[model samples]
Each structure stands twice: as C-alpha cells, then as structure tokens.
Target: MTKIFIIAGEASGDVLGYRLMTALRALRPGLEFSGIGGARMAEAGLVSLFPMQELALMGLAEILPRVLHLKARLRQTVQAIAAQKPDIVLTIDSPGFTLRVLKAVGANGPKRVHYVAPQVWAWRQERVKHFPGLWDELICLLPFEPDFFAPHGLHPVFAGHPVLESGADKGDAARFLARHRLGPEAVPVVLMPGSRVTETKRLLPVFRETLALLAPHVPNLAPVLAAAPGIADAVAAYTANWPHKPVIVRDVQERYDAFAAARAALTKSGTSTLELAMAGVPMAVTYQVNPVSAWFGRRLIKVPHVAMINLLAKRALVPELLQEQCHPEILAATLLHLLRDDEAAAAQRAGYAEALASLHAPEGTPSHAAAKAVLSVLG
Candidate 1:
C-alpha cells in the first residue's frame, strides 16, 4: 500500500488536492492518504492531521499576529510527517507555511512533491535557485512555468491549469438570470469578493460602494453577489444594510451561470479574474491589503500587471485597481466602461482565447498529470 501524506492550506489548494487525490485513487486504489486540508479534501478521504485552517493564514499583516501559532503548527506538522514516514509528501500552495514544514522535514524526508509552483517570475526570482534542493518534483499548472524552473536544474511538468476543467462546465445564463429575478434587458454586474472570510471582509465593502456608485449612472443595474462557498452568510451579513441588496448566488452551478450572464464584473485580484476570463466576462480587478503590507508588496512585486489574464496575455486585458486605487469611483468607472462600451468588452473577451490556449493541456487531465508526477517521484 502506498502512503501519501498531503498538505493543502486553503480553499483553492483543497479543491486541487481533492482532485489529485481522486486521480491517485484511480491509479492506485489501496493507497493510504492523510493530510492537512479543508472540507473538500476531507470528502476525498484525507484524515487531516490538523485543522487545515490553522495554516491558511496569508499576507504579511494578517500573518504577523499569528506567528507563534503558525510556528506551533509547523512543529506539530513536522512531528506528524516525521512519525508517519509516508512514501510521498505532497504540499499544495501556501508556500509560507508549507515551505517551513518542508524545511523541517529535512532532506531525508519522503519524496517531496510540490504542486502549484510559486510565482517566482513575478517576484523573488532568487527562490528558483534554492527550490531545486527543496522538492524532488515540481508540478506546475501553467505552460510557460517550466521554462522558468527547468533552467534552474528543476524539471517541472506542466499539468495545465486546473481552472481549465472547472471553467469548461458552466451553468446556463438564461437559467441564472431568471432565477435571480434579473430581466434579460437589465444589465447584471457580478461581484465576486473572494472565497475566504478575510477576503470578503476586506473587499465586499469596496464592492458595495462601487455598486452604489454605478447605480445612479446605470439605472436598474441588477447586481448579483457571487458568494464563494462557505462564505455566503458572511457576504449577506456584510451587505445587509445596503439600500438595494445584491442577490447572492451561493450555488456552484448558479454562480457560473451568473458569470456567463453578467455584463461586467468587479472581482478581487486572484483566480476569480481567470474565472471571469474563462466565462468571457469583462471585468475590472481590484485588491487591498494592510497599508504596511501594500508598501512591502510594492517593493517586491516586479510584474507590470497583477491579474493572471494580463500576465498570460503579457498585457493588461482588464483594468487593475489595487491598494489606494481600489476606490469605489475608480472601480465603478472601469466596470461602467465595460458595461457601456461593447468594443472594450469585446477586446477584453478576445484576450481570454490567448490566455486559455496558454493553459491548454496536451493529452491528460491536470489531476492525472499531477498524480503521474507524484508517483514518478515516489518510484
């Protein structure tokens, strides 16, 4: 029996970890699986060594207060992994926490396979130089990622973007509009704050303010808030006092449908940008961090654009409003532009093709490709 210990620190990583676990089960049925993950991975047979949320902390400001707790979890995780002595130790995303745990595991640790290569190309280019010694195999999701890591004595296998599959099966636009009481003639703007509670708390107010700014100009604007899983109640509570409450779509299928039907979107800066692009929805991306964190990030971030769609396209496909620029008026203006200008919307939608093509996998599914890489490392 194969012993596979996995670590997935957040919602996105949990989803990917679940998919990879299912694929591994398909290849080797009797494998023993244990890890740190959320609900999705729990359903995929991961008896988490610790509550995954303990390691889900992000951003410098957010993580500062939790340093002692994080270090404690690190020690706990390291002790667990050492005692288990699994054939493979797979860490997915959350480099801050995962890498520390990996370092503690030492060189003699089980075949270390890391999924979702860190964005060294954007910042911290020096990480690539040291990464070759940390992990045994690197499984990347982007086609161009291998070029960045391979030259550093690390052979990365491009398993295609996981979003490619999730984006493929979307809901019906007509069904979504009707269910949300949105008329076909009315303009619908989708607001995706983020999947996490912290993200929702940070961005929902700005999104709400942005919507208010647009309401006067775009009459009868039907705003639908796409509630990321497990955070629907938080989204609702935050928007409870609004003059015109945004319709919250919590269902997975309905959220995708809402994306398809939306004229434009105001989303946080992350995977949602790519999700909107996959749905061919024009959007303006916005993000905010603690002022000190923003100041630190400004120095480290080398990329011209922050959105993945723009990164893959090597140009700005959509407007990005970050930190101080993520104001209601500015965000609303760009979204209003997307709603009003067909030419601009069409141009942004056109960028999606190139971005998707860049994420296209050659033969196998991303989960299977990732599983193969992990298995190869174990052998």
Candidate 2:
C-alpha cells in the first residue's frame, strides 16, 4: 500500500489539493491519503488531522491571538508525519503552517513536495533563502515562477496554472440561460465581486451602481454573481436594493455555468480574472482596498500589472481599475465597452488564448502534470 501525507491551508489550497489527490489516485489506485484539508479535499479522502480553519488564518493579526493553539497543532502535525512515515509529504500553500511543518519534518524525512511556491518575487525576496531547504520538489502554478526560482539556486517544475483545470470552459451556457429564463435578447453579465467577505463588502455596492448605470445601454441585462460560500448571505444583503437582481452562484459548477452564459465580466483583480479568461469572457478588473493598504501595496508590489492574465501576457490584456480608479462610473464604462465592442472583446479573447497557452503543461492537464511530478519522488 502506498501512503502520502498532504496538508493544505485555506480554500484555494484545499481546491488544488483535492484536484491533485484525484489525479494522483487516477494514476495509482488504492493509495492512502492522510493529512489536513477542507471539505473539498475530504471528498478525495483526506480526513484532516485538525480543522483546516486552524491554519487558515491569513494575516499576522489573526495568527497572533491563536499562537498557542497553532503551536500545538504544529506539534500534532509533525507527530502525524512521523507516525505515518508516508512515502511523500505534500504541502500546498499556507506558508505559515505548511512551511513550518515541512521544516520541522527536516531533510531526513520522506521526500517533500511544496506546491504553489510563495510569491517571494512579488514582495518578500528575503524569504527565498529559507525555502531552498524546505521541499525536495517545488511545484509552481505560474509559468514565470520556474524562471524566478531557478535563478535563486532552486529548481522548480511549472505545473501550469490550476485555473486551467477548473472546467470553466465546459459549462452549458444554453442550459444555464434557459434555467434562468433569459431570452435571446437578454445579455448576461458575470459579476465576480470576490471570494472574501472584505472584498464583497467593498465591491458589491459599486457593482450594484455599475449595473444600474449599464441597464439602459445593455438591453434586457441579466447579472450573474459568482460569490464564495462563506460570503453568500452578505452578498445577498448587499445586492437586495439593486435594480436588476443578480443570480448569485455559490460553488464552482454554478459559477462556471454563469461564466459560460456571460457576454462580459466585471471582476476583481485576481484568479477570478483567469476564470473569466478560461471561459472566454471579456472582462475589466477592479479592486479597492483601504486607502493605506492600497497606498502601501503600490510601493511594495514589484509587478506592473494587477490582473494575472495581463501579468502572464506581459501586456495590458485586460483593463485594471484600482483604488480611486475603481469607481462605479469607471467600472460601468469599462463593462459597457466590453458589451458593445465586438473587436475589442475578440482582441481580449485572443490575448486570453495566448496567456492560457503559457499555462499548458509539457503533457496532459495541469493536475496530471502535477501528479506526475509528485509521483516522480518515488522513482
């Protein structure tokens, strides 16, 4: 029997971890999986050693109060790895918890693979020194990451962006439109406020105003919202007063269906952009954080672009409206341009193709490529 210990913290990591587990199992049957993960990974048979939320804390402020609890969980995770003595130890993201556990396991432990290399290139270049000794195999999602790490005396496998495996393009748009009772004249617009509560709180009001502004121009406009499960109710509350009520989809399948039905998308500047790009939806990215955070981020961020698609394309493939530029008027105008201009939309889709092609693995899908990389540890 083959055994592997895997740990994933936070929702995104959980999704990636589940996909990797599914791919690993497809390649090798009857494999044993044990470690920490959320509900998604549990579907793939990872009974988490502790609540994944324990390590899901994002900022230092959140983690400081739970230091003792996290320390104990860390010890427990270290002990579990020692007891299982699995063929491989796989850690996905959550540099706070996963990296510590990997470090504690030491170089003498079973072959270790750390997926989603930390974005040291973005801000924390100094953190790169500690990472060289952490993982036997480093699996990065971005195409540029292997180049970034190789120069630092570390070899990494670019497994392609996980968003490619999202099944975003496989949605039944006709069925989705029919189910929503949208007619041929109706134009479906996808609204991705964000997956986090803070983001939804900031963006939904602006999104509502954007919709109100575009309604007269876009005939029979239909809004489809892609919201995270935790923030769904909040999204509902925020959008209750909007003129055109959005059909909010909580999970991936529903969101993908909505994406397929969409003529254009208004999304925050993140992975949601990639999701829209994968579904061939023309979009404008918008983001507004607290004044101070935005101000600091402007200085700290090394990259020129905010949208991942643009970053990957090495050009302004999509419009990014940030901070003061993220007003309802700007977002509304940006979205209206996408809905009205066929040539501009076509150009964005072409760039989407170019950007997404960079995410293709040397063979098969990204998940399969990642699985092959992880399995290489044994042979």
Candidate 3:
C-alpha cells in the first residue's frame, strides 16, 4: 500500500491539508495517510501524532521558552514517520515546525513536498535557498511566489488561494440580519480578533475598545464577532464585559455569512484579511504580538504592510495598524472612516475586488492541483 505522511500544525494549515487530502483521495483511492493535524484533518483520515493545537502558537518570544518541548515533539514526529516509511512527506504551512521536521526527515533522503509557501516574499528571503535541497517541490497559494522562488533555483507551483473555493454563502443579507435578531436596516460591522488564543488575548481588548468608540457615532451599527471553534469560550469571556454585547457566530460557514452581511470589518491581519477582501468587505486590520517579538519583528521584517489584503494588492489598499500602532483609538478611527466615508470605503472595496480576481486559479482547483503535485512526488 502507498503511504503518505502529511503535517499541518495550525488551523489554517489543518484546513488546507484536509482539503488536499479529500482531493487526493478522489484522485487515488486506497492511499494510506498519517500525520500531525487538527480536527479537520483527522476527519479527512490523517492520523495525528499529537493534538494539533499543541503546536498552534505564534510570536518568536512566546515560542522561545518552549523550544525544548517543541524539539522533543518534532523528534517524536520525525521518528514515527521514518518508521512508517511513507512514499512522500507532505507538510503544510507552520514553517518553523514543518521546515525543521522536514530537514530532520530529509537527512534520511525521503522525498518531501511543502504546501502553502512561507512568507519569504515578505521577509527572510534567504530562506528560499533552503527549499531546493530540503523538498522535492513547493506548492504556493499566491501567484507572485513562483517568480520569487524561480531565481533561487527552486521549482514553485502556484496552487491558487484555497479561500476562493470556500464558496461563500450568497443568501439574502436581510435573512442573515434577521436570523441574528438584527434590524434589516442595521449596518453590520464584523470583528474577527483571530482564531487562536494567543491572537485573541492580544487583540480582543483593543477590538472591544474600538467598538466602544464607534458605538455612539454609528447607532445603526451591529458588531458581529466571528469566533473560531475551540476558542469560542475564550472569545466569549473576553467580550463578556463589553457594553454593546456583540453577536457571536461560531461555524465557519456562519462566519462567512456574517462577512456577507457586514458593511465593514475590524479584523486581525492574517488569512482572514484575504477572506474579507474576497467578500468585498471594507476593513481595518490590526495586530499585536508580544511586545518583545513585535520589537524584534519591526527591526527584521522588511514588509511595509502586514495585512494580506494590502500585501496582495502590493499597496496600502486597506488601512493596517500593527504592533504599537494597533491602539484601540487608532483602530476605531480607521474603522469609522471606512464605515462613514462612502468614497474611501468604495475605493477600498474596488481594490479588494481586483485583489480577489488576481488570486483565481488558471485551471482546476487549488486542492486538485496540490493533490496532483503530492501524487507526483509519491510516484
């Protein structure tokens, strides 16, 4: 039996890996699978070595103290995969963990495939040099990444952004408004602090404060908080004291519906920024990492913009307040500008539409393309 080992350490990577697994199963039935992934990947038949959430962490400073624990887990995972002798080792995102494990496994000369290209385009461009020798192929979600990898002697395939296939719900916005007990005429403002505990802890307080500031001016506004699964309790606890009591939605589909109904959004800068852009929701992106990590990142990272919406547009299409700039008052002012200023909001929405179009795949779906690439490596 052909065996494939895949590793995806966080929520986004888990979703990507799961979709790829489903596509691979359709292409090649009876393929064996094992890996490190989350609930979604487990549902897709991935046998995880550890609970996926165990590795879902962010910020270099936050991760520094846990290095020994992570190293032991990596060794355990690599040894298990080596013993299984999979035909190909496929890793999705989570570069810090995935790439290190890939290097350890590559030492034994196993074929390797990496999905969801790291943000080498943003910073640490030198990391691109490590891929050609570490992995057989790299599958990227962004179109511009292949060119970035070409000059570095690495073959990179643009698999297209997976969010396009998410098939956002297009039902009546009024229905979503009604179901959430909101007035039909109310302008919805969605708040997505983040899907991780670390992100929510760092950003929710600022989001709540922003909401407080905007509540009075935008009387017709109803804030919708999209809480990612497994972090719902944390999100709820964080917002329990807020005076406005924002509406909270849990399911991913429901969250997309919230986006569809939203006139504006205040979101943490990440993949969700890409989703919001696709939904054509004008937004203000904010992010806050550990103070020390933020300090170090500012010195090392070369990118001028942090939000994926602005990064993909190759300009400041959406307002981004990151690190020290992620103050609640600034976030409030940026969000209010989008909510109240028609011209500015329309311009941002138009830019988002263009950025969304730029991400569409040339042929087939990204999941299919990624699966095909993995199968080729397995062969």
Candidate 4:
C-alpha cells in the first residue's frame, strides 16, 4: 500500500484536496492518506496532523504576528514527512507555505508533487525557477498554465478547473425563483463575499451598504448571499443587522440556482469569479487587504487584473475593484451598470463563454487528469 501525505492551506485548496484524495482512492483503494487539511479533506478520509485553518492566513502583513507559529508548524510538517516516509508528498496551492515545506523536505525526500501550480505568470515570475529542485511534477487547473511552466523546466499537466467538474455550474433559474418565492421580474444579484472568516467580516459590510444603495434604483432587486457550508450561521449572524436581509443560499443546488438567477454579481476576487463566469453571470469583482499588505502586493503583482476569469481571458472582461477602489458606492455603481445596461452585461457574458472555452480540459475531467499525473510518478 502506498502512503500519501497531502497539505492544503485554504478553503479552495481544501475542496481541491478532497476531490483529489477521492479520485486517488478510487484508483488505489488501499492508499494510506494523511495530511494537514480542513473538514472536506477530513471527510474524504484524511487523518490530519493539524487543523489546516491554522495556515489559512493570507497577505504578508496579516501573517507577521503568526510567523513564529508558522515556522514551528513548518518544522513539524517536515518532520512528519520524514517519519512517515510517504511515497508522495502532495501540496495543493498555498505556495507561500507549501514551497517552504518543499524546500525543507529537500531533493532527497519523498516524491514531491504540487497540485495547482503557483501563479508565477501573474506575479513573482521567479517562482518557477525553484521548481526543478522542489517539485517532481505540477498539476495545473488552467489550460494555459502548462506552457507557462514548461519553459522553466517544470512539468505541468492541465487538470482543468475543478469548477467545470462540479455540477454546481448548472442551474434551474425558474425553479430557483419559484422555490424562493421570488417573482419572475425580480432582478437577483448574487453576493459572494468569501468563504473565509476574515473575508466575510471585511466584505459583508460593504456588500450590505451596496445592497442599501441599490434599493432605490432597483426596487425589485433580490440580494442573494451564497454562503459556504460550514460558515452559513456565521454569515447569517454577520448580516443580521443589515437594513436589508439578503436571501441566504446554503445548499449546493440552491447556490448554483442563485448564480443562474442572478442578473449580475458583486463578488470577492478569487475562485468564485470563475464560478460566476461558468454560470454566465456578469460580475463586478472586489477585494480588500490590510493597507500595508496591499501596498506590498502591488509591487510584486505583475498582472493588470486580480480576477482569475479576467486574468485567464487576458483582458478585463469583468470590472475589478481592489484595495482603494473596493468602496461600497463604486461596487454598487459597477454592479448597477451591469444589471441595467443590457449591452454591457451581454458583452461580459459573451466574454465568459470565450474565457471558459480556453479553460476546459482537452480530454478527461480535473480529478481524473490530476490522478493520472500523480499515479505516473508512483509507477
């Protein structure tokens, strides 16, 4: 029986890690899995060494105080890898922590496989330079990523975006509207603040204010908040004091239905942008970080846009409001424009199709492709 150690630091990575673990298990039924992951990975049968949320942090400034703790965790992880002597050590995303772990594991440790290549093409192009010494192989989500890493001597396999594999992209808008007791003419706007606690705390107030601003202009507008499963109650509590209580969507089917029913979306810039795009929902993306973190990020980030959909499309297909631009009024105005202007919204929807076409895998699904790549190293 082969032993596999996996690490996934954030919610998105946890989801991807869970899917990958299930697929890997399908192929090798007796595979022993252990890792640092969240609820999803634990549910998928991993006996985690530590709570993955401890490493869920983002931004350099935000992590400053926790540096000592993270250093200790990193050492503990390296020691775990050595003691376990797993056939493979797979890390999904969280390049900041994962790369350091890989470096400590060094050239002679277990076969190091990194699922989801770091966004070197977007920023810190120098990251690919470390691949030869660190990772034995890379599994990428985007179709265009392999070529980007190949020139740098990194082996990259396009596993497609996990969103395409998830049936969540498909929806029944009419049924959704009826289920929610919403009228046919109600203009629903999907509000995805984020899955993280910090993200929700920072963005929900802005989203609440935006909803209030839109009330006068769009009397029939329905604000739908798509909350991630574990944090549903927290999301509810956070928005309880708002002037308008958003129609909170919890279940997977309901969330997708909400996405389909949306005339537009105001979402945090991340993986959800791709989900909204997959649902053909035109969106205005925004995000905020500590001012110091934002200032440092601006210097390192090479891309023109922060939204993954826009980045992949190689153009600003959707409006992006970041840092200083992520004001309630600006976000509301951008979303309002998308909702009211048919031509602009249609254009953005068309851009989604074009961008999505580029993202789809040429052959198998994401999990399958990723499993095949991982299995190859074992052989």
Each prediction's RMSD to truth: 1.6, 2.5, 1.6, 1.8
Residue-level lDDT tens digits of model 2 in 243-275: 899987878888888888899998887778888
**What is the Å distance of residue 83 in model 4 from its true position?**
2.5
Candidate 1 residues 15-39, lDDT tens each? 8898999989998789898879988
Candidate 4 yields a Cα-based lDDT of 0.86
- TM-scores for candidates 1 onward, in order: 0.95, 0.90, 0.95, 0.94
lDDT of 3 at 12: 84
lDDT per residue as tens, model 4, 201-262:
78888888988998889989889999877688999888888787889998778988888788
Candidate 3 positional error at 6, Å: 1.1
Report how far residue 298 has shifted in candidate 2, in Å: 2.0
Task: Give, for candidate 3, the lowest lDDT window spanning 10 residues.
Answer: 166-175
Poorly placed runs, candidate 1 (over 4 Å): none
lDDT, residue 42, model 3: 83
Give the clash total for candidate 4.
0
